[model samples]
Target: MGSANVASTLVYMAERCTSMRYLKLIHAHAYRTCLHQHTVVLGKLFRFVAVSPFGDLSYAHNMFDQMPHPSTFFYNILIRAHSHSTTPSFSTLFFNRMRQNGVAPDEFSFTFLLKSRSFTTPFVYDTHGAVFKFGFSRHLHVQNTLIHLYAVGGVTLSAGRVFEDALKVGLDVDVVSWSGLLVAHVRAGELDVARKIFDEMPLRDVVSWTTMLSGYSQAKRPREALALFQEMRFAGVWPDEVTVLSVITACAELGDGEMGRMVHRFVDENGFGWMVALCNALIDMYGKCGCLEEAWCVFHRMKRKSLITWNAMMMVCANHGNADDAFRLFEWMIDSRVVPDGVTVLALLVAYAHKGLIDEGIRLFESMQRDYGVEPRIEHYGAVVDMLGRSGRLQEAHDLLTSMPIPSNDVIWGALLGACRIYGDVDMGEKVIKKLLELKPNEGGYYILLRDIYVAAGRTVEANEMRQAMLASGARKTPGYSWVEA
Candidate 1:
C-alpha cells in the first residue's frame, strides 16, 4: 500500500476504533504495511488507546515497548493517560522510564503530569523542580497548569507565587491564567482576594464573571452573587447556562419571587430554557420562592428531563409538604425507568418525615437498601428518627437510634429528646438529657430543652439545677433574628 493509503487507514482507525478488537485489527494492518513505526500512525494509535473507552493503559504501554525507537510524543501520550487514570503513580513511573530511555520530555509532558488530580503536593512541587530544570518553567502552558494544580490543591500561596513569577518573566497573562488564580483564592475562602484579582483584570469574559458569581453562591453570600451577576449583565457579557444557574440559585437563597420570575423570563427570552440544567435550577428557584405552580410549569414544559430535573421537582414538592405529589413523581420516575439513586430516596424520606407518616417512612427506609439498593446514610437515618419521634413512637425511635449501624449524630438524639418532652416522659427525658450532655456538654440548645422539660413538669428544683449547669458550662442561646425587606 502507498503511504497515502496507510495514512488514511490510521485516520479511519483513530475515528472508529471503539473496541480493543478494532484496535488490534488496526495494529495488525499497521505491522503488515510496515507503518507500525511511522511516527504519525503510532502517535494517533497511542493517543486513541490512552483515552478510548475500550483503551487500556497497560496494553498501550506494551505496544509502545514494541517500537524499536519510541519518540517522546509516544511517552507523553502514555504519561497523559496514566495521569488521569486511577493509577496516577504510573505517570511518574513512565516519566522515570522516559528519562532512563534518554527520551527528552516536552512542555505537554510536564503540564499533563501536574494536571493529574491524584498527585500530592510534595509530588507536584518535585515535578515543578523538573519543569525548572527542563527550562519549560516559563512556557505559558506549563505555568497555567501549575497555577491550576496549586489552586485545586488548596495551595493558594503557591499559586499566587507562580502568578507573580509569570509577571516577573514577562509572560503574557491570558484569561486562563487570571482565572486560575481567581479559583485558587475562591477555594481558599479568600473571596476578598478573589474579588481583588477579578477587578484588577483588564478584560473580563463570561468565565471571569461566572467564577466570581459561583464563588459567592457557594460561600452563602447570595446577595453579593446576585449583585455581581447584575454587573455582568450591565457590562453586556452574555450569561451561559452555568452563569444563569448560579444567578437562579442566588435568587432562590434570597427567596425573591420577583427576581426568580425575572430570571425565568430572561431564560425564555434568551432561548436558554431548552437546557435541562438551567430548567432544573429554575424549578428549584421557583420552589424556594414559594412559586410551586411556576415550578411545576417549568418541570412539565421541559422537552426532556435529566435525573436532576426530576429530583429538583420532587424536592419542590417535598419542600411544600406535598408528600402525595412527591410520591407521585417518584412513581413517575420509576415508570420512566430512571433508576432512583440515594438522593431520590433522601427527598422522599424528608417528605415522609415532614408529614409524620411514620409507618410509610419506616417502610421506605427499609426498602431503600433492599428494593432500590440505596444504602442508608446518616441523613436517611436522621429522617427516619425524626419521622418516628414526631409521630409519638418514642420507643421505636430510640430503639432505631441505638441499633443503627452508624453512630448517632445530634439530630438523632435531639429528635428523641423533643419526643420525650412532647410525651411528658420525665424519666426518659432525664436519661436522654444525660446522654445529650455527655455528647455536647457545652451546647446551650440541649441544656435549654432539658430545663424547659423540667419546668413544664413542675420540677422547679431540677430546672434550677439544669440552669446552673448551663451557667457553669458557659453556654447560652444567642437570640434569634429575622430580616425583613420593608
Candidate 2:
C-alpha cells in the first residue's frame, strides 16, 4: 500500500478497535508492517487508547514513548486526554516534556495545561507567565482559559485584569471571557457584580446565562435565579440541560410546586426527559415542594436511575415523614442492585428519626459503614443525635455528640439544645448552650433558645440574664421570613 493508503487503513482500524485486545492486535499488525514508525499511524493508535472507554492511558504512554520523535500535535493529544483524567497533573508533566523535546507549545497546549491544574495550584501562575513568554497571551482561546483559571481560583482581580487586557488589546472578548469573569465574582460571593457583568455582555450564550443562573441558585437566591431564567427565555437564549437543571434547583429551593411543574413540563417538551440528572433534579424539586406524589412520579418514570436518583427519592420520603415508604425504597433499591451510599443511609436515619424510632436509627447509624461500606459522616451523626434528642435520651445524645469522631457543628448542638428546652433539662441546656456559644457566639437564636429553656423551667432570673448577655454581645435575632411562588 502507498504510505497514505497505509495510514488511512491504520486509522480506519484504530477507529474500529473496540477492546484493548483488539487494539493490541492492530498495534502488532502495524509493527509487523513497519508502519508503526509513522506518526500518523501512531497518533491514531494513541488517540484510540487515550480516549476510548476501554482505552488505557498506560498503553497510550507506552506508545508515545516508543515514538522516535513525537510532535507537538502528539503531545497535545496526550495533554488534552490527561486534562480530563483523574491525574490532571500528568497533563502539565507532558507539557514540560514537550518543551524538553524542543516541540514549541501552542495555544492548545496552554489551554489543556490550564485545564489540568484546577487553578488551586500555584502551577497556574507559572502557566500564566508562560502564556506571556510564548507570546500566546493575545490568543483568544488561551486568554479565555487563563480567565477561567483565575476566575475559578477566586482571584477576581487577576481574572478581571486578564479580561480587560484582552479587551484593551482589541481581542474579541467572547462570552467565555465574560462568563469566566462573572464566575470569578460569583465564587467570591459577589453576585451583584456577576449580574452586572452578565448584563454587560454584548452577546449572551447558553453558558453565560447558565453560569449567572447557577450563581444565584448556589448563593441561595432562588428568586433571582428563576427571574433570570425568565429573562434568558425572553432573550431567546435556549437553555441546555445544565440551564434547566439550575432552574429546577431554584424551584426546589423556593419550594414552588407550580414553578417546578412548569420547568418539568419544559424538560419534557424539550426532550430533556432522558437526562438522569434532570429527572433527579425534578424529583428533588417535587419533593421539596411538598408534592410527594409528583416526586414519586418523576422517580418512577425515570428509565435510568443513578444512585443520586434513589437517594433523592429516599430523602423525599424521609423529609415528608414517610418512614415506611423510605424503608421500602431502601429494600427496593437493594433488590435492584443499587448499593446504598452515605446519603441513602442518612435518608433512612432521617426517616427513623422522624418516626421516633431511636433504637432503629442508632442501629442503622452503627451498621452503615460495616453493612453498606458507607462511612458515617457528620450528617449521620446529626441525624442520630436528633433522633436520640427527640426521644428525651439526653445523656445518650450528649455522649454521642462528644464521642463523634468529627467535631459537632452548631446545627447538631442546636438540635440537642432544642431537646433540652422540651425536657426542661436546665443542666443539659446549659452544657449545650456553652457548646453552641463556642460555635456561634453571635447567633442570637441559640441565646433565645437558652432563655426560653430558663423561662420554661421557671428560672426567670437566669432567663433575664441571658437576654442581657445577648444584648451586651450585640447579637440581634434574625428576623424570620417566608417564601411563596408569587
Highest-scoring model, lDDT: 2
Candidate 2 lDDT tens digits, 1-486? 777887788889898888999999889988888888777778788888887778999988898888888888889989988988888888988999999879999998999989997733664888888999999988999999989988888899999999989998889988788889988999899999888988898988998899899999988999999999999999998999999999999999999889899999999999999999999999989999999999999888899999999999999999999999999999999999998889999999989988888898888889888999988888888888888988999999999999988777999999999899899999999999999889988888888888888888889899889889988998768565111111
Model 1, span 367-468: residue lDDT tens: 888999989988888878777777878778778887888777776798889988887777777877787878877677787777777778889788789778
lDDT of 1 at 239: 90
- The TM-score of candidate 2 is 0.89
Q: Which stretches of candidate 1 lie over 4 Å from their true place?
A: 1-36, 41-63, 117-123, 354-356, 421-425, 481-486
Question: How do the predictions measure up, each by TM-score?
Answer: 0.87, 0.89
Please report the TM-score between candidate 1 and the true structure.
0.87
Q: Which ten-residue region of model 2 has the weakest summed lDDT?
A: 477-486
Q: Which RMSD values do the candidates have, in order? A: 4.0, 3.9
Q: Which pairs of residues clash in candidate 2, taking residues 3 or more apart in a chain or in different chains? A: none
